[model samples]
Target: MAQQFEDKFRRKFYYLRLSVTDVCNFKCTYCLPDGYKPSGSKNSSFLTLPEIHRVVNAFADCGTSKIRITGGEPTLRKDFTDIIRVIADNSNIQKIATTTNGYRMERGVAEWKEAGLTHINVSVDSLDPRMFHQITGENRFHQVMSGIDRAFEVGYKQVKVNVVLMKDRNHHELPLFLNWIKHRPIQLRFIELMQTGEMDDLFTKHHISGVTIRNQLIANGWILKVRENNDGPAQVFVHPDYQGEIGLIMPYEKNFCDSCNRLRVSALGKLHLCLFGEQGIELRDLMQEDAQEAELISRIQMQLQNKSVSHFLQEGNTGMTPHLASIGG
Candidate 1:
C-alpha cells in the first residue's frame, strides 16, 4: 500500500528526525543543567541498526524523503556513520543530515560526508571561549571551531550553526557572533530557548525573543536581504558584505505549526507527532509485537491521521520531561 502521511489538517509530512542515541557528552546548563540524569522511559531499549533501518524503510515507504539524525550527540553511537550509510543506500531517501554538538566532528566529518551526509547543524553557543565554556560546561571551544572548519574543508553543501540565545546568558553575543560569522560560509541560526516544563524557571530567566534580536541587527546596520526555505523553521537572511546567511528560529514569537511537515522518532522508538506533544505511540513495541510488516505499516499509517494539528507548547502548558537531550532537539 502506498500513501502520504497526512493528518486531518492535510499537513503532508516528508521529514523525519530520528534520534539515534539518548546519550550525550556535554552538559549544557539550559538543556541538561547540573547533576542532571534523564528520568528513564518505560521502554529504555535503544533501536538496533536493523531496527532503525526497518523504521527508516517504513517511513520511506510512506514518502519520507528527508531524514535528520539527532541525539544528545549523534557521534556517541558506534555506527553513526553506518547509520547514515544505510539511509543513503536507500534509493527513496533523498536528503540526509545531522544535528550534533561537534565534539568529535573534526575526526568524523570526512567519514560522515562520505556516508551521504549533505548538511550538518552544529550547536555553537558563542564565539567567546569563556562564554562557550559557561554555556556548554566544556572547555572544547577551539575544538568545536576546528570541527566546523573541517566540515567546510570537506565541502558540505550546508553547514548550519545553531545558537540558543538567552537573556542574561548569551543575548549579548548576537552582534559578536554575527561579526564572526560575517566572513565565514557557515549558516548561523539563533533558536529561541524552548520551555521544557522542568526547566521553566531557567526559561523564564533566559528566554529572548527573536524580534528583539532582529531589531538589534537592524539597529546595527545589518540588512536582511532574502528569505529562503519556506517550509523549514529558519528565517534566513544575508547581509550585503557577509559571506554567509543568518537564520532566526523564533518559535515563541512566530507560529510554524500550520506549515509544519515533519515527525520525530526518539532513540527508543517513540513516534513524536510534534515536539511538544507529551504522549507518543510506543513505535518500538508496536514493531516488535506486530509480526507482519504490512500490519506495522498499516498501523503507522492509521495513526498519522491522529497526529495533532498543533503542539500547544505555550509557556505554562509544558511539563513533559527527560529534557531536549532525550528528545533529540
Candidate 2:
C-alpha cells in the first residue's frame, strides 16, 4: 500500500499527523485567545483508543508508514502510552513519533519511549524562563528543560525542539536559542508563526516571516548550514562549525504546498486535507456506524484524492475553519 500512498505531486504520503486529543495544558497567547470558549461541549467528542487504532490501521492500509501522535498536548491523554504501543505494533508503520509541549514530559517521557515512541519534537519557544512563562502561561520552564534532558537520558536521540518565530515576542531569542542547541545532538526548528487557531491578534501584531528569522540568525553571527532536504516542509540547516542542525518551517512566507504529501487527522476523526482548510471528511460518523474496513479505507483514499493542490490560506488569504487544538503542527 506504500505505493498507493504516492500523490499526484510525485511525493509519497508516508507520514500522517494524528491528533489524539484536543485538550491542552497550556494557554499560549497565539494558539488560544483569552476568554475563549469552545463551540462544542468539553466532553462532546473525541476518538477512543480503539477508534484511533482502527483509523491508524486504515491509514496504514493506504500506505501511511509514519505516524506522529499530536494533540492540544498528547501527553495529557492518560492512554497515550497504550496508543503508542498500538502504533508501534502496526506492521505497516515504519516510525512512530510525537510533538509535545514537554510540560508533563518529566513525568512520562521515559515511559513513553518504552512504549514504542521512537522520537519526540518538543515545543520550546524561548530559553528565558520569564518569557517562557509569559508565552506558555505556565511557569514550568525548569521542568520542561529537564524533560528535554530526560529525553536524551532515555536514549531518544532524534529529539527536536520547535520554536515558533513571533515578532516582538521571542523573535529576538533566535541567537540565544540557537546557542543552546548548537553543539547538542537535538535538532532545533524555528517555525514561522501562522494565523491559525486564535492568532487573529498576534497574526496582525507579531507575524514574522521565515526569511526574517534566517537573516536574524546570520546577523547574530550564527552561520547556518544545510542538512537533510526532506520533502515535509521545514528548511533544515546546520552550523558552519557546529554539530546539531537548525530548521526553519516557513509555512506562510515560503509555501511548500506543491510538495505537500501529508494529510492531517484531527483527534475527533475529521480528515483535514490542509491545515488552513476548513472542510474535512467526518470519519467519526463511519466509525460510529461500524463502517467496514474496506469502506473506511476507501473513504480515506477518496479524501486524499480530493485534497487541494495547496491551502487556500497559504496565499495570505482567509476563510478557513478554526481547527482548535485537535489539529497538530
Candidate 3:
C-alpha cells in the first residue's frame, strides 16, 4: 500500500479505532467509574454514514489498512453491522475488527463475519456472577459469558478475551480464567489497567503489573514462547499443552508509542492521535458541511503532524484523562 498518513515522528498510520456510537448498555467500573453522563452531543454532531465513509476512505487512501469499530457499545447502534460492511467493501482496507461488550453477538455475528469481520475482542473482566455484577454495576455476567461462548463457536480468524487485571478484583482468578478457556481456541489476554482517568482512583487501588502476572505464569509451569510475526502490543505466550495461547498487555511497563501505527476518530468526529491525549482536531463539522476530500485530508494531516512521540500516561501519573467511551477506547 502507498503511504499517505505519517506522523511527525515518521510513524506510518495504518490502523483506525472508529467509535461508531457513544451509547452503551453497561458502565463498567473501570470505564465509567464516575458514572458521568455527558449531555448527548446534538444529533447533528455525529457524522452520517456517508461522512464515516469519507473519513475512512481518506485514511484508506492514505494507507490505513485496518479499522476497528469500538463503542460505548457499538452494537447499540441500529446500523452497527453496516459500518463493518462499509469498511470491508473498501478494497484499500485489509482487516476489520471490533471491541464489543458482547451482548449482541447472537443476533449479528454471522452477518458481521460474512461482512468481512476478521477479529473480535470481548471485554470480560470476571467469570464470577457476583463480582461481574459489582464491577459492571449490572447483572449481565451470564449474558457476557454466553456471548463469548458464541464468539468461539463462530468461524472468525481471531477471537480474544480481554481481561482487565486489577489487584484483588479479577487478578486472583487468573488461574480459573485460564482453566475455563483451556478447551477453547480463543486467545485469553490479561490487560493492565490503562490510567485513562475514568478509573482514576480505582487504578491506584487495584492496579496489577503485567510482570507480576508473567512471573506467576512461569512459576505455574507455563512456558514462554513467541508468535512468529505477531507485533501488536500484547506480549503473547502459549503453554505446550493448553488449547489456546495467552497474552499480557503491559501498557505501563512497556512503551508501545515508538511503534504506534493507529489513530482514532470519535463518534462525534474528533481526531484523536493518542489514547491518553488531551488535544484533538475537529473534523465532524468539516464532514457535516460537505468539505472537499482535499480539505478533509489536509485537516487530518495537520492532526497527524501534531501527534506526539508518547502519551504522558507512560510517566505513571494517575490523574484524570479522556473518558474511554467518548475517546473511542
Q: Of the candidates shown, which would achieve the greatest TM-score relative to the real structure?
A: 1
Query: Which residue pairs clash in candidate 1?
Result: none
Off by over 4 Å in 3: 34-36, 40-44, 218-231, 288-291, 316-320
Q: Report the lDDT tens digits of candidate 1 across residue range 1-329.
A: 36877788887778889998878888897888663465576667677777788888888888788899998788989899999998888788887989999989999999999999978999999888898999899999999999999998898756899999889878887668777877888788999888885687888889888888777767766666553221357777777788877888876653657778788898888888777776667778555532555665777778777876666665455636547887788
Error of 3 at 28 (Å): 0.7
lDDT tens per residue, model 3, 1-329: 33489888888877888888777778788887555475455653455688888888878888887888887788888877788887887898887888887878866788888878888888888889899888878788788777766665777645788888889888899778888768777788898888765456787799888899899878877876663221456777777777777898887765667768888888878888877775566887666444566678888887788887787576865433466787667
The C-alpha TM-scores of every prediction are 0.92, 0.90, 0.90
Worst ten in a row by lDDT for model 3: 224-233
Q: Considering TM-score, where higher is better, how would the candidates rank from best to worst?
A: 1, 3, 2
* Reference-based lDDT, each prediction: 0.80, 0.76, 0.77
Which wins on TM-score, candidate 1 or candidate 3? 1
